[model samples]
Target: MTGTIYSLIPPLIMIILVLLTRKVTLSLGVGIIIGALFIHEFNVMDSIQQIWSAFYGIFVAEGGPNMGTFYLLFFLIFLGMLTAFMSASGGTRAFGEWAITKIQTKKGAQLLPFFLGIIIFIDDYFNSLAIGQVARPLTDRHKISRAKLAYLIDSTSAPVAVLSPISSWGAFIIGTIGAIIAEHNLSNFQPLESFVRMIPMNIYAIIAIFLVFLVVIFKLNLGAMRKHEQRAEETGELVDPNRNDIPGELKEEFVQTNSGRIYHLTIPIVVLIISTIAAMVITGRNNVEENATLLTIFENTNVNLSLFIGGLIAVYHSAIFYLIQMQPKTSTFLVLREGIKSMLPAIYILILAWVIGTIIENLGTGDYLALVVERSQLSPSYLPVIVFIVCGIMAFATGTSWGTFGIMLPIVGQIAVNSDVNMLLASLAAVLAGSVFGDHCSPISDTSILSSTGAGSNHIDHVLTQIPYAVIAAIITIIGYVVLGITGMVWITLILSLVLLFATALILNKLTQS
Candidate 1:
């Protein structure tokens, strides 16, 4: 079953189940078990062992704990606590009160996260959760839907991070591109230059960013998102009332200070941003060789550790503020407990997602998809779009863009080298673009889940509402890739793609309104 069409069954079943039942945890659990069974040829003992090993691997690998996963999970927990403390301290209410005077419009509330998402492009994980904490109050005050807020965060985080040279995503991609160049013996290819060049060719990311602003500025809510928006506008219900397990939602009642100020919220976030960046730089510096440049430092930075440090500091800071402001009877222990409790649902979903992702990888789902792409002897002109679609499918199924990049980049490199050297960058850009598009649509994707957690939206609601917008951008990206493949003109293709995207968005907005 490994590295064959049989490997596709588990993910396909999982996806179908999620869409039909909207039960993420159950669906993911079933997928994990089924994948394990398939990998072990239905041998009960071996399957059980495989499942255990995969589950164990999330926290333990080799001889030590998996710090990356641990750090991220802790970050989420701390972020939740931070949010709870901020709210309990009246920071959120104060921020909302302040925003009402400053923003004064629903459009401005929607735009806050959009712009913040772009401005904070160091890492998608940080951007997704942090933006939610900062902007949720404003969006809620203005009656903006949580689904829309999730879309804004999801749309901006990856697109901006993927494009920025200093970001974690960019550093990884550049390093990967360098290895591919060395392996293929493409001496003329400069990794940094190639990455910069591919930025414009990443039609999906660029167009996704544009689509977010267009949707916000033009009020282009479509499909399920329209329903979410309508509900928020009419009833002031930011989230779907039916969903009881929304993560990052502080349901526990706590006392708020009459003297709540915007600075209470802003200070902790600022501390987080500054401290995280400082940790990244410090960690990067420690790991780098003596003549390391800023880019190399970022490439070697401990992003998870940095995030953990930042979240820890922010939580501590918020707690101090909360303690000073809260009523005498409000126990600190309960606030912390409630904050942890609020994040448990997200944590479970994440762990399940990791386990299922591991099972699918063990089943060689990505390998099967990569094999299909490798076997296709398509024209060079079709390679960009073909790779785009394949990479998208792989990421969507696996629910991990970085995983898809690891599996597909090498294959894309080899395929582009053998087929047409001219299309290498275009094909490479397609991998990044398509992976993000697929991640945007995948219900199991970490960014999507985090985006939902961040915006306090129902996870399934975020996925359902965001898919239509992602698909539209992807369709436009396909056309853009086709033009890039045929013309080999980055500037022309990018310009035309943006034009088409704006025109499509405008037409759709007008039509949807009618």
Candidate 2:
């Protein structure tokens, strides 16, 4: 009943179950039930009612955070429609044929996803799915592993979003920091300034992104990734043998429609990108000062609404394109149906992840952990590293970086103030970086799950292949925080960390090859 050791049980149960059974949905569902039971004094009926209420509350509640969930769900559906239409129109096939001429090498194929991921930094969810859908055909043609493609998708989504000043991720962080400042009456604090200053100190994101380039450039395949890549290269088996379906198999019904023109693919995607950016700017204009920069507009934008509008426009554009080409209206509609259906599994997982995140919040897990840190006798200089490790662990266990941020930001803010931690920016960056690092590793993470779905790889396979790379980044990030904590020199810490990461990548390459 108390926020003590009992608070840890739900996440521990979820993590243990996921690892053992490899059933992310069941694990999260059971974890939520356990948390409900704890909150309801072990009364099974009461716990069941509480669980139902929580699920219901996500939709009907006024001013609920679940609006973001709704936005993401619609985004997925429309994205599915877009992909379906592209495949049925022969856009993906035509694009693949075109791409192979320019990107003939395996390294170029791998790098394409990396580049696409970086360019689509508006939202992580959109980034993961769009990059996966667009780049899969190219990667497959060159015999690249789906696992590596998923890693590229997952790594770029969160890392790039968090680092970009004009992104949904940045807006969320700013809002969180703003709330902390207002609640605590921190008169001297400036959320935007602090957020901008902390960007470079987000070492995990930087390193994770850097590692993607290294892996693609140097062909550094370690652990299960190496096996997958070797299998793909030697046998042209892009999909893992253990998986029941091939990557991008869901689009097979539409592949026969190949129009033999790259424009079939490029047009819809261009429409999607341009419309989304325009929506963001127009929607956010009212909230900004005169002559506001793009970053300011993004910070003020209703990202959920912008994404919804953009998605609908993209769907309409694709549908119209097909109709103009003399395709039957029914055929276009069929693509819509098939696309939405393909995304249903991912949508289900996303809902469950949200519910589990709600349960963790109710259980006071983050508060209890923060209290433990408050009571600790650790030195002030170690706060950044400690916070980084704890945030990483919390995010890994909970599978929601936003949830982790909501829980940890206030606690870290207080710690920075009370402990006189001169490295507040470094500490803030640690929380952001660590949350992303843990999310990258967690099987139940929405981004991780979606990355797998996007790349048509097994969910667990993506997690297994990505862990070594994430860990490498996490280790280096921890070292960066430690150096900043000790020296309070941001530039020096950054230089040393970059060198360390590059060196570590070289070592990994040598060791993996050996």
Candidate 3:
């Protein structure tokens, strides 16, 4: 009993710290110390020992963070580099400039991003950063706030990844849940089918994205976040205080490639999509016993070879440009280095996040948190909402969504099996939805901070501004999940959540006007 009370102290303190100060790095570091102090119950010297032990556990626990972590982290960063290489080669800018010429209206401004989100269905991490970078200058030209642009990029990121069966996220989610079910000896039904069904029912992502479209289309009235949004509308000369004292003409003429051409930019992304799908189909064969590891899919699929060949093709095309005297050696080097350097922030966060996850797992936060849920009357019928809310709070407190999901997924699986519910569907949705919800609200979250940085807004400002919209989506999504519990869920929750939220948004607009 005392142990549990001590365990609860750390996470609770984290919440108060974030609410008061909104500093993500400090919040996360403080939370770790709190967990170390209370949960581990270590003597002062032993606490230091345990903290080092947890960090070691992540980096060297055989197949722990060392093996699995590298695959996703490298995959994402390299994917970013490939996209960067293409932009440097003049692929992305061609598209951006061409769109500026062709799409002259505001409606076109909105649709362009939605289409990009739909088309870039390979990976969420890739989707968020790539689309956000590509669409920024164009949307800024038309007065779209960085927050709105970030929302567009973010909404499309995981939501599209969840729906698309071929992406790496699809592979990880399916593989994780599938393995857990099989471990518990309950692998009777087709898990992929559940994944497919859940796609239509991923209410929060669908609804949030839908609200973005509506907000842009109707030029809706901003409520709580109007100040942040209005900041984007100002045309006054506020110099970027952080810019190095480079000449304006030099910066303008610096040949930003990702925004320049379509072929280089589009080809690599399209190849990535094709390769990811091919990997999924090859590994996910039979759906019931698709025991595909990351290595297996990477080695088996010709499409990855194709992606590599496509990357080679990009290099080869650049070679041709050098022959034509359009390529500069100095410029190409800068782009590659820039691309690698650009992903460092994300990479550092990934490493720290994994370490934190290891700490929580070792300290038995999951078991303690699980005990709370079990005693708290959290029924299966209301599991989605309850789990969603809980996971969100945990993620927000801890500042690590992946870590939150990793802990929650197993507990959710245990509950699902115990309740005789569709464990795969219910548990997976809860983790994904919960992670995103917490990430959306968490000031310390990598994505949350990145979105704010991308928008050039203050991180706390972004969190405060984004919360009302995110909460609206979360609330309506809980209702949609509840509706499923009642009606046996004829349609997908994504569709229902979108419809319900849109109606609520319209009503909000009406109420504000009245």
Give the best candidate by lDDT: 1
Candidate 1, number of clashes? 0
Q: Which segments of model 3 are wrong by more than 4 Å? A: 1-5, 15-22, 53-94, 172-188, 199-201, 220-225, 236-341, 376-380, 398-410, 413-432, 444-463, 486-499, 511-514
TM-score for each model: 0.98, 0.92, 0.75
> How much does candidate 2 score in TM-score?
0.92
Q: 380 in model 1: Cα distance from truth in Å?
A: 0.9
Candidate 1 lowest-lDDT run of ten: 323-332
> Where is model 1 more than 4 Å wrong at Cα?
326-329
Model 1: per-residue Cα lDDT at residue 501: 89
Give the range of the ten consecutive residues with the poorest summed lDDT in model 3: 244-253
Error of 3 at 170 (Å): 3.6
lDDT of 2 by residue, 1-514 (tens): 6377688888888888877876667877888899899988799999898889878877767855667668867887888787777777777788898899999998898888899888899988778777887798899888888889999999999999998877988988987878877876777778888788888888889889999999988889988898998999999987766565332346455434534367777888888778887888898887887988776787788776777888889888776666666543346556777888777777777788778777777777767776777787767788889988988888887788988887788888777777774656677788898899989988779889889878978777788899999999888988888888888888888889999988988887788778
Taken over the whole model, the C-alpha lDDT of each candidate is: 0.91, 0.81, 0.60
Say which prediction, candidate 1 or candidate 2, comes out ahead on TM-score: 1
- Candidate 2, residue 367: lDDT: 71
